[model samples]
Target: MIRQPFKARTPEELISLLSAVAMAILAAIIVMVLYYGREIIIPIALAVLLSFVLAPLVRLVQRLRIPRSLAVVSVVVIAFAFIFAMGSLLATQLAQLAGDLPRYQSTISEKIQSFRETTAGRGTLERASSMLKDLSKELDKPKEAANSLGTIAAPKAASPKPVPVEVLQPDPGALESLQTLISPLLHPLATTGIIVIFVIFILLQREDLRNRLIRLAGSDDLQRTTAALDDAASRLSRLFLIQLLLNGSFGIIIGMGLWLIGVPSAILWGILAAVLRFVPYIGAVIAAAFPLALAVAVDPTWTMLLWTIALFVVVEPVVGHVLEPMVYGHSTGLSPVAVVASATFWTALWGPIGLVLATPLTVCLVVLGRHVERLEFLDVMFGDRPALSPPEIFYQRMLAGDPTEASAKAEEFLKERSLGSYYDEVALRGLQLAQADAERGALAPDRLTKIRDAVQEFANNISEQDERPSPKVNPTTDVEATSAIEGVAEDAPYESLRVLRKEDLPSEWQGDHPVLCLAGRNPIDEAAAIMLAQLTDAHGLSSRVEAAGALSTANIFRLETAGVAIACLVYMDASSPAHMRYSVRRLRRKLPKATIILGCWMKDIDPAALESLREGAKADLAAATLGGALKLCIEATGVDSLGTGAEGQISKITAAS
Candidate 1:
């Protein structure tokens, strides 16, 4: 008989798998409820999210030796103050918006009519007219038939005395039934009260509560459970806080911008944006529509509507793309796929409230998976991706930078699970915009620092973050001896390229596998999925797209969420194409084993110039072997050899960009 090595599951392993599956099912149900009853879901979810937000402050007050009841009172007062401020602003905006509605609608109608007159416009208008005509015909038939009935009824009423009012009334029991219908609402209110009290007590006696919980888990596993719960609480709290700040900022920016534009209900729109940001994809679309409808109703001009669209275009991106990262770089560690899945699932079960709770709930599930055995798979699938772990990520990058492997590590995150919340639709848009810029080669290197800096800022409170030490170099080193004296030469940019040495390549990259690193305006997120299907396990072609995901722009979000890494760092050189530079720099720095390839708009390229650049980077500047040519190109992009260009020009592109 052959002896086989056996593997034993630990306590944490046992908990992870089972907990994941159970939580996933719960999340699914919650999503279904949210989808079916959005209006009801919103307030409930808002209250729950708010509970988390206020819980901390309540606890802080309690910690100061105040009574828990008093702390609850203090939290309530703060909530009222906040609500009043928001309500007042919202009221003013609504009033103004209402007054301006007719004008905006007329303006939009006029634009539509104008558009109809143009050649392309005419076809679109005709189709729309045909559709509208059909709808009107259908609608008018019912109205006309109903009106005929009304005429016939007039004779009957005249012919016979109307039934006595008392006779028409339903039985007394029916009235009681009507009252019963509202009983459900009353019960929810009672439940809400209980939840509030529960939350406050939990917050106030947090320390004692934790101690009790630790004891309950048993001495053998007490430390582990306590740590897991604490981690969950801390991370959950941090995420909610970051989300709140980001939402508020978006609202303020949108509101102020509308006001400055002289658009009606500017304040209301801003407040609306803020509130709607909490909703997923649907929220931004809705928020934009309200403004668009108002813009059209007020001006009834194509130009005015166009201006409104432009305003949203300019404002939404800055707020979502720029300010969003700056404010809420908190990584909940869920993959984009998992996030969407959870959001969808919870929305199905619990409605919008479920959506809001999805993320936190998922985090709790991940915690539970750490305890239970059956749900361990979920922890692996949905937990913060192993790719994000600096050590593992560093090791992979070191192993001859296999983007496929990097993608795999990132995919590992998908196993961790999620609770879907539409906390930042604007953030998603910003990410899309960044990807578009990356495709166009319009991105500037300076933007990445702004982006990364913003990421760092947004994710400031995250645990286990490495503290970077100020760099200290040896004075006696050959490269440092002369260059160190001049800070400019010695100042190493975090971005890469301008040089490609053997050491810069990793063990995985140094092999026989052919590699293609594609980047463009329409950056595909499914590369890993596609690559995974095509490659063998030995190939190591997996989810690891690069070393860093969100490099210089929120556009990198698709890649970030997909578990893509940035291969290299780039300097802001506007004269150089931003997209190409970013792509090349990334491949140069991040992927040591793989060669970087550029994805470009076919029309935009000057074939002759492209050939020159291609040849310059390769052997004979014209060699045909994929690996050799790629190596040549890497050599050409090496720093020091490529002279610098106008950085201010690059800065402008990023700023207005």
Candidate 2:
């Protein structure tokens, strides 16, 4: 027998496979380029970030009537001059600290001796040390015994010990001494020079560079390209500026606190804190280490050390958690995990500088992902925004059999929206998706059953919540709310819906089981009916839900319809309007006096076709959304307080009938 080759089932599958392979290869190539070219790229990346920080300052100078060239030159020089002064001050502080370290040696020794005494006084350490000594003695006993035996057995003359030889080279002259002194400085100095040159050129030619980037990215879509660039620039600039301000303020506070706490070189520690904190997560820890060490050395009593520890513990959290968020306001657009992961990745590729630049670079990637068509996965992966919409999330949770999370999501959405709106916009749409999958034969029976159970569970969880918007809140009348309900038939206009209070509803609708929500065919339809029933019950009208089987010929006669004022037939799959018409006819026969409304959750049906469906089914009205069906039920209650638009729509439909 011969084996057949595997193949993609569709063009889309084949294309997706090829595209994924291409992306993986592209990613590998990019990583290689980044790693191999870091010597050249690192300096340029630093310069670019620096330019973003300094661009505003240059613009400010230009606003003062300075020429562009002069402004660029002045800003670059001033910025670097300030950096140089800070470096010099840091060096001076370091030299002084080093010189003063010898004075603390006695205190350090005393501390060490005290620690040793404390540990020795504790029996645990002493026991471990004594055990090691005994073990060594036992192990050496055999060797010593052998040596004694050899000596007693008239061992040969002791072998002469070889003398040790040492080799030395001549001392270095002035050139070599200078080379030795400057070798460590050469890389940093060269990098600084390259960065300075790059920054100056970038600031001078910023517009030209932006144009080139736009052309390279997408000249045909100038709007998108410009927007992407503008977004990236604005975000990067804001992030850098806010971070600088916040970190600087933090450092100042830390310095003052450390000084009051009697820590040595508080100013130096503060500067280090401000500078090092540009590296995310671990920067504050590194910055605190120096001051903590000095605190321990400067004060033998441990008071200063404890104070320094407390200072960082309290101050860093306040700055990072409180101040940064308040100031940043989603400026970075990077998730916390993305920030850390990008830091690790870039640090691997470009070392420490990459750690500092990770967030800004990832921000550019996110902005590009948001604006560019092909790179959207980057935003989905790294951006702080939710990757999936509410309906998709709800559907996915149902698929995962997580009713709790689905209910939680519904509750969260309900905080700002009525439960009816949530059902129309989120839950019903999610069920529609399930219906689509089921129609496509993609959903297994057991999986469908799980989804049904999950939906039912979710409905039960939030059933008690009021369906009306809070009195203090103004209800949303946005077109989006209506359009979400209408699904794909956006051209069909919908009337504004309002859930009426129980007292506001007519006397007939105030009775028990005024509305009967019957599932059209499947469990998905049943789930949708459950939503409608919840909505109707939440509003003033009493409602009950029955399965599709309950509406079968055998069970139809058994269903109690004495108090049912309205019968809402729900069909998640409305492709076969014949079946819906049949169901509607059956319900009409059972409840001849009750108003019949068809709730078609289908996405593709148009208004004309829906009206045709309603008329052919011999139903009084039809709606594509839960909200619409609920509104129809409310209007059926003979309430006149509905908005004029709603009343007009009801009148038009009634007259047409």
Candidate 3:
């Protein structure tokens, strides 16, 4: 038998695992209780949601010089009266629809006959009947006497005398039968009553309830609790108010459309559409199904059905895409997936009521999760807020070796910000991610290669596609240095090796004094170096990039003779600056006249460690970001390289008459 090694978990890891298990158990218990106690919980949830919707109305009524109780009573009565009146109208329409249903029997029969004719022919039905008759005859063959071929018939046993048995049953009276019939109705009616009373109380004492909840959950942080409660109330109230207006408008449009199309009981279908649409995702389709079916039943020519469908198709898209988004604007704070999942979850827990309440309930959960420290994971998992910022997204895509998407994201960002900002925020962070992975040895050699290749592609392609032309360094001015830089990679794009000519130099900048950007030992370092070069070029500063380790004695002499003024060494993941100190010191020794600035680019930095690194490297300055490094380089060189023309051109051509 072979014995395997057992790895023990750290204390923190163990505690985290146990905490996750406890949370899972607690969640399961909550779900179970919610499902079983829905009879009580559902009404409370409904009351809370309705109160959120109606609280504004109650407040408005209270502002008319009426007592609070009177305002509540008046608002509730008016609301219920409107609902009851609508219900009566619907009942009357339903009765009329029922009476008219028989008139459509001829139409339905005609449709059936048409379908039969289309499927085969009128003779097909008669043929089918004849076939069935023949089948019946064949199945009803008389049974012959048992053949003696393979069986010997046993003699019949003597018949026994029959025994009598008596069974007793109780008859249900009319009252018991009536009670059985109305039991289901009684539960629903009682729940409605409870919801009404709860809504009234909730509106009357909303402030007291809110204070109690804050004290219970956030006594230590009352400000945060109050803010969270206010946010939740405002969001839910706005959602309901906007939703009511949109749905009411939708119903009106539906009614008008149906009435124009001569659909019977158009108002009934309109009300149903408005009500059913409160449920998300599939509600519109379900609401459409009823009217569509009724249209078919009422009309033999299919015109009404077609028109009904067209009306829904047009209105739904217009409202959903245009008006709904314009009004809601991320108000619910539930993601699309979260909305669907919550709908399914709540529907399972409390049936249709749960489905109707899903979005509001989820909005509440998201708000709580956002404000409560312990429940923050819920917001992280379910909220509509972006899970990743643009930079993180770009970095992740690059790590996954998807340059196309990463480039697309970069391009989208470029529409709003400068190219240098994009490089600093997105490209630099991406390189840092690669550096971290490489340092941890989590990235395989081939994967690292792919990531490097992808990032390079993104950088090169995105630069070319920029609407503004990027500054280019003229190779004629310094052929040797340009060749030395360009020869580093035979297939490298121009984005990695552009040099500004004398004509493009800023007024205060000398053509000979360009910045020399050096890459460290890794590809990430080279990527950062390229980013710095791009940024420097954008500011009308001539710059050239080369790998520090790739530089030869001859190349160094050529660069020295090239009259470069600043040598910027970029290191993306130099934890201690041990590897880069030698490069900076060497560059300082070779280019004694030039300023040496070490670019220690990272997302986070320790000031002490950075100071020590700068001191050890014998460099003039150390910066944590590309922007800072560029600033240092500018200050050291004493040049403000902002350009006045397109593509790092500091002077614009004046049109002479």
TM-score for each model: 0.46, 0.86, 0.78
lDDT of 2 at 24: 95
Give the distance in Å from residue 620's predicted Cα in candidate 3 to where it truly belongs.
Answer: 4.6
Clashes of each: 105, 0, 3
lDDT of 2 by residue, 207-301 (tens): 89988877767657787688768877777777787788888898899989998997777789989898878777888998999999888788988
Clashes of 3: 3
Against the true structure, whose lDDT is highest? Answer: 2
Better of 2 and 3 by lDDT: 2
User: All candidates' lDDT scores?
Assistant: 0.48, 0.78, 0.73
Predicted structure 3, TM vs. truth: 0.78
Those runs of model 3 whose alpha carbons end farther than 4 Å from true positions after fitting are 119-184, 430-451, 469-502, 506-515, 536-544, 548-565, 577-580, 593-595, 604-616, 620-624, 628-640, 645-657
If the candidates were sorted by their lDDT against the true structure, best first, what order would they fall in? Answer: 2, 3, 1
Each prediction's RMSD to truth: 20.3, 6.0, 8.3
Where model 1 places Cα greater than 4 Å from the true spot, the runs are 1-48, 62-65, 84-105, 119-195, 208-221, 279-286, 303-307, 319-330, 355-357, 363-378, 387-657
